[model samples]
Each structure stands twice: as C-alpha cells, then as structure tokens.
Target: MARSLLAGHRLQHELESAVDIVSRASRMAREIQKRYCDATQTVGDATTLAKADASPVTIADLAVQALILGELHMLFPEDRFVAEETSSSVQDERMEGAIRTWLTQYSTRGVDERVRDSIDLGSDAGGCRGRIWVLDPVDGTKGFLRNQQFCIALALLVDGLAELGVLGCPNLSAAQEAERIASGYTEGIEGEKCLTIVNGTDGCVFFAARGAGAYMQSLTDRREQALPQQIHVNANTDPSWAVMAESVESGHSSHSLTGKMIRILGIRQRLGVDSQCKYGLLSRGEACVFLRFPRPGYVENIWDHAAGTVVLTEAGGRVTDALGGELDFSHGRKLPNVRGIVATNGHMHPAVLAAVKHVLAEDVTSG
Candidate 1:
C-alpha cells in the first residue's frame, strides 16, 4: 500500500513537471516564430539543411529540441528521449553558432558543448521498457516558414502507452478569446461570418494526462488570469454535417485518397492544415474528423503523433490506424506496426473507418 501511494505521487509530480517544461519550450518556439514572421529573419536563415529523407530542419527545430532536452535532463536526469531533429543537420559553423546563441537567449544555463549534446540526445532508440519522452520540436517546418499552422508536440510514454501530452500552437487563437470577440459583433453585419478571428499572436497551449481529460490555456507572457479550461470533441454524429481536417501537403498524406474517403463518408467541409494543430482543433471541437492515409510504403514516426493522440483521446476523441488498430509505439523511433492514422470525435469513427477501408481496398484492386 505504501508503494502504491508513492508511485501515484511520483506520477503526479512527473506530469506537472512535463507541463511546465513544454510550456517554456513553447514560448521559445513562439519567439522564433515572431522573428521569422516580422521579416526580421528569413526562412533561409532559420533553415539549415534537409535530413536524409529530405525533410527540412530549421534553427527553431534544433534550438527547441536542445531547450526541451536540456530542461528534461535537469528535471529527470535518468529519463530518455526520442526526437525528430539532430545536430548533424546543422553542418554550417555559422548555423551551429547561431543555434547556440539562441539557446543562451531562451535558457539560463546554456553550455555550448552540453547544448549540442542535448540536441543529439534525441537519437536514442525508444522501446516499451521504461519512461520515454517523445518530441517533435517543430512539427510542420513548411507551414512555419509560411507563418501558417504548426505546433511543438511533446509526450511521455510509460511502457509504450502515452501518459502525458502537451502541444504548443503558435498560430492558434484562444477559443475563449475568439468567443469573447465574436460576442461583441452583431449577427446581421455584412461580413459577420468573415469577422471571426481564427489566429492570434499569444496562441494557445494544450496539455493532457491520462484519465484527467484535456485542457487549454493562453500561451502568453502576461500574468493574466490564465486558467485551464476543459475542452472536448464536437458532438456532431452525422457524416454529412461533419468537417474533415487533413494535411496541406499531398505528399504527407494522399490528398486524392482523402478526397475519395471524404466523398464516401459524405463529409461536407474539409480543412487543410499543417502539423498536430489539426489534433488541437479536433480536441477543441473545431473539427469532427482528422484523417491521414500516407502513401503505401511510408512509415510514421512516433513523435509525430504521440502527443496529439493522447490529447485527442483525453478530449473524448478516438485515434487509430487506417484499419482501426491501436498505434504501437514499442518498436523504437518509428511506428513500424501501424500504417496510416485516423482520428475523430468518437461519434463517427466506425463509419469513417469503414469508409477508409473500403476506399483503400478499391484503390488497391484498381491499381
């Protein structure tokens, strides 16, 4: 009985620590966003090089990874991490120096060598054995370059099951702020529908722990009355009335296939977005369905979806593979056992899964 009580206490402490660490990391990421968005810095300045798979890595990505890993190391020295970015991508001496400079700006104790090591610490191969922290420092680099939707996603897994998740959406408007502003405008104005504010500078931070539900709060510097408010998935069950959120890049997920599935499911509106912010939107009841059917031979990284999966599930939503299999994260960095992903508000998951299966099978036979 004593051991049980101690374990519970440890879990609570870890969850709280994770929330604080991710929030600080999010703030650092927003500073990078402001620099790029305001024309003070260019995309070329932030982008260093592409990975072997041709995905771009920017200064923000490497810097955020270093910041988060550095903090986690100080907080939980024994914990392991799996992240997307690596220091090797920053081959240019100037770029590497720039990253170190930003590290000092964001964190208090930034040792040059130690910070570089922290960025490389993400290469650890994670398994289902012990506590593993997963991170995608900058989930959608392209979207971020365009000053569009993106996120900094983080999650903690115990024995391969997600225990905690946090996401920072720098371009997302606070739901409460949105509603408050919307309330002031009269309904019958000429551009009333277009007047809705969808994005803001302060942005939002979403966090969730297993069985504790999900909550969102403002990601701002002001010491305002920022209390976490519970959020959930939309209650819409009818397919015809549902909206689908998908990736903006076709290569990430087959847009043609998604369109076909959307047609089959009779979903009327489709929102093309970037990064895990789609999951954030779904968790906050903005969208009813989120779909991603990667090309036939593509494998997904656990960091890309781990945080979003936990956040959505805790917000009364459901997540699964294209064939409705639970995502298996025990196989190191990549989700080798899972193929494509499908997320919804749990109301239309069955119908959506059936439609996905039917569409994919038809495509297979036709090809």
Candidate 2:
C-alpha cells in the first residue's frame, strides 16, 4: 500500500509539473516585465533602432526577449524555438549599441551563441515542424514603447496545435475599471504610476491544454490552494447584446472589416485591448466574442493565439478559423491555411459563425 501510494503521488506530481510550466513562464515574464518597467521608468522615452525593414526595435523588446529566451533555454533544452527577432538587429552599429545597453540591465545571463541564435532563429523565416515553441517576445511593440497596454506572448505547439499558451499583460487590472483600463496605470489601484501586480488581485493569466479545461490566475499569485473557475460562452444569441474585444492597433487586424462585422452583428459596444489579454477577458466571461481579421495575403502566426486557444477551449469557449474550420498550426510557422480567426464563448459560437457567414454571403451577393 505504501509503495502504491508513493507511485500515485509521483504520477500526480508529473501531471502538476506540466501545469507548473505555465507558472514558470509567467514568473519569467513578470521578472522581465519588472526589469523593463524599471529601465523605461520615464514616459515618452525610449531607446530605438531602425531594422533593415525599417521597423522600430526598442530596448524594452530586446531586453524582454533576451530574458525570456534565456529562461526558456535553461528550462527546455531539447525544445525547438521559432522566434521573432534576428541577430542582425543587434549587429547594426546603431542597433548594437541599443541592444547591448538594454540587455546589460535586464539579462543576468550574459549574451552568448545561444542567445544570439535565439534572436537569429526568430528572424530565420523557416517553417514549423515537429514539436516547436513560437514566441512573439513582445506582441505590442508600439504599446510597449508608448507605455500603453502590451503583452509578452509565448506558445508551445505540438503536431500543429498549441498545447500551451502564456501571455504576460503587465498593464491590465482585475478590478472593474470603467470602460477602458487607463494607460500606464494597472487595475486594482485607484491611480499610481508604480508597478502593480494584477495576477493575484485584478490582472489575470490564462492557460489551457488540448482537453484539460482552461484556468485563470492572478499574475502575482500562484498557489494551488484556490481552484480555477471554468468559463463558458454566453448562451445569449442576440447580437445587439454582445460585448466584444477589438485590436487597439489597426495594423494587427483589419479595423474596417471588424467594424463591418460588428455592425452586421449589431453589437452595441466594441472594446479594444492589446495582446492576448482579449482571450483572458473572454475566458472570464467579461466579453462574449473576439475576432482577428488581418489584411489579405497576411497570415496570422500560430504563436499569437495558440496558447489562448487552448485556454479558451478548456474554459468552455470555442475557437476556429473565420470560415468555421479548426485552426491548423502543423503545416508551418505561419498559419497559412486560415485567413482569419473567430473566438467566442461556446454557447454563442454557432450563432457567431452564422452571423459571419451571413455577412460574407451578403458581401459576395452585393459584389
């Protein structure tokens, strides 16, 4: 009996270990976030570089990416990584200075070939296969630079599906703060510029596996004592009653198309947020639906929504391509097959699908 009990306990421990990986990722995100928040304490200030593509690269993005990659390498050695940054960004004299300075403050692990490769791998432009990790490092660079709502996004993909997702939204609050969360200020606090934790208090972290149900936690707290609340989509099919989340950055999605969809659905209020926090909101039942319809020819990356998909699914929500098919991440790095994605509380998913199809059909007829 004693041996059997020990074996059972060990089995439970392994099961919990998989769950603990989410916390480990979250912990790293928070640590990097703290460093980033500290380095950029001044508002309207930043260290910038011009990538070859001319897109802006800030110290905050570099520092945080380095921090996360360093931790990932240590934690999962055999795991492959598909990332967003390339070493070339750090090689440019202009970018090199910024990279060295920013990383100096945030990276306790000195830069090495592995770190360089991690950045380079992100810029590698290779397709995904087998088991791989996809990282946005920082999803909303503009938001991060502007000190608006941004997030560090990480996802683990296995056989083309996101098995795990971890999003660190530093600026969100758990407390009900009016219509929009104030910029620079987190939730729970009345008003303060200092760094505040929303995880245990008002801000939440969402996680889920394929079939294991979704769970939410306060960013600052990670105790198993409290059971995670399961969530489901609203059964209300009335489009007028729907509350939805939209992208704050128009470039990340198609605002015009989103507006049209919203109008068609007759949703009265449309909320905007940065990063995967939209998934967090949906999981908690704060919002009923979320949509990401990017421009034509631009495919959405798996890293951006993989983890969130599992979390929402586990929470009784449904996620799929805009055409109502399941998201397929296995083919390659970019989700090439799907043009858009729709996420909703399970109850409203079919209705949402019908509404989307109706609108598209009408557009075809009108054209």
Candidate 3:
C-alpha cells in the first residue's frame, strides 16, 4: 500500500510540493554554478563566497540548504528537517550574504534575520518521530565545483523508512544515457555536454513514493507538460555482466578492496560520478552495483543516503550496509552503526554480498 504523508495528507500532495521545491532548488544551484564558473566573473567574486581556504562551491551548498529547508518549513509547517548546513556554519559574511541573497527572493523575513533563523530550521536531529525530512541540498561539492555530476537529494522519513525521494542531477546526459545503455561505451560527447532538455543545465530528476514505484523526468519540465517515465533496476543476474557505479572521488571509498570484489565477481564497466547520481543511475537501470566503504571510524551521514535509498528500494534495488544489514535511520544524523554501504539490483545482491564478505575476510587476514 502507498504511504500517506504527514497527518494523513495524501502522498501525492507532498510529492508534488517536494518535486517543485527541489526543481527550483536545482535551477537555483545550476545557475549559481554557471555564474561561479563564468570567465567574466572575477576570482575575487568567487573568493567572496568561499567557505574555508576559498572553496567557492560552498556558496551553492549554503544557498540550496537555506532555500529548500526554508520552503519545507513553510509548506509542511509542522514537520522536521535534518539537513547538512545550518546558520551557525555560515562562518563568513560572504557565505552569509550569498545565502541571504537567494533567500530574499522567497522570504518576506529580513535578510539577516531570515538567513539566521530560517537556515536553523533545518538543524533538527532526527528520531523515530512524527515526520522528518532528510536533505542533502548539495550532495557533491567537488562535482558541483567542476561542473560535473552533482545531485540535490531530499526524502521524507516516517517510522524510520524513506517514504518519498527526489534527486536532481544537472549534468548527466540523456542521449549519452541511451547510447551507453545500448553499448557500454558510446561515441564520446565532444566538448563534454549532455543531450538534455535543460532548464538551467543538462540534467535529470528521479523520484519515488514507497510502493508507488520509481520514476524519472527531465530536470526542467513542469508537471502540466512533464513526460515522466517509470524506471526499474536492470535484470542482470550475472555479476560478470554487471555495470557498477561508485564514487568519482578516490578518497570516498576503499577502491582497492572494491576493485578486488569486482575482479572476483568478474564485473566490468564501472561508471563513477559524484553524489547520489550513482543512485539515480541504478534506479533508472543504468548501473546495477554501487559500493561505499569509507575509511574506518567515520560514520556515514544519513542525509547522504536516505533519498537515494528510497528511490532505489522502490525501483526493486536492495540497499544495505557492507555487512548486508538494513540501513537504520531511527538513531540520529549519523549512521554510526553502519560500517559502509552496498546497493545493487536485487538479483545480484547475494553474489555481490558474498564477494564483499570474501574481500573483507581477506582484509582481516592481511591486516
């Protein structure tokens, strides 16, 4: 049965609002991204928006968190949000000014006061509670900085499970997607551009409501004229035939171990992108395997995984920690109990899980 949103509100209404807020957030982010990279824009301008050590990408992260969380506060009113950025994290005036500028368009509250109070609305720590929204307003800062594949992810968690999810990826190519689906490698995109019907940039959005099924649509389309397509995990039972997805950043996982697992399983054709775009790839049947084995002692953040988990889960994919345990979200902001994450199309899970275990056993023996 499909789940209703907060207070018996239809899931459809919440889904609609979530999609709109995320869509607009995507537009805002990509536009900020474009301007950040513009040749005409002075380095000083980007410097002004930097977080620490002059990383300009922090601007987009702060801006998106502020707007989306603020909008969520307005629409849902009574719900809670656990988000990445907060008003206190705005350490510099440049960060504060940039966030305030974006909030100005949507907020009637004074810029400074709105900036402080509004962003704080997202700082709630989650629990097994009434309704909690998990948001990663900017899922991959590295990808966003380079104009590569970054995603904006949001989900509503009720009773410790993600009931609704939306992912906005503004860099993946639709034409390349079709070509790559046909042949693992397509004729390269010259100048590196995606064939997307762009709103602000070439991108796509994937969403799901539990039991209702997962779907994808163009990043820019409005509901009235949108061409949403239902999606599912690919039916590839053989690990040797799998196309795997992983993080683009080498530091994000223990690649050496993952490579051993892939080699043992005879899997080929790994596609790595930043952020939850990996989940979007899987839910749309583009890739079948994803692994995240962060360095020891680092607890996985819930905001990073909740949205993708629901989209993939509804699309017939299975997500769990490296040990094949369920990802429990009832605890708090960090998934302290989870060692790492592994997601795959359901058919390949057992085989993949065995390979992961085999590799871990070897790691223990070697250590």
Clashes of each: 0, 13, 0
Candidate 1: the clashing residue pairs are: none
- Highest TM-score: which candidate? 1
Sort the predicted structures by lDDT, highest score first. 1, 3, 2
Q: In model 3, how many backbone clashes occur?
A: 0
The parts of candidate 1 lying over 4 Å away from their true place are 1-10, 37-42, 108-113, 176-198
Give a tens-digit lDDT track for model 3, residues 66-120. Answer: 8887777877899998987766567777667767777676444334446667667
Candidate 3 — what's its lDDT? 0.74
Worst ten in a row by lDDT for model 2: 187-196
Cα RMSD of predicted structure 2? 7.0
Candidate 1 local lDDT, residue 131: 88
TM of each candidate vs. truth: 0.88, 0.75, 0.85
- Residue-wise C-alpha lDDT for candidate 2, range 260-314, written one tens digit per residue: 6666677755666767777777776777889887776787776777767766776
What is candidate 1's lDDT per residue for 31-100, written digit by digit as tens?
Answer: 7766765433256554546689787677889888988888788778898999998777777777778777
In model 3, the Cα lDDT at residue 107 comes to 44
User: Which is the leading candidate under lDDT?
Assistant: 1
Model 3: pairs clashing at backbone N, Cα or C within 3 Å? none
Q: Of the pair 1 and 3, which is ahead by lDDT?
A: 1
The candidate with the higher TM-score, 2 or 3, is 3
Order of all candidates by TM-score, from best down to worst?
A: 1, 3, 2
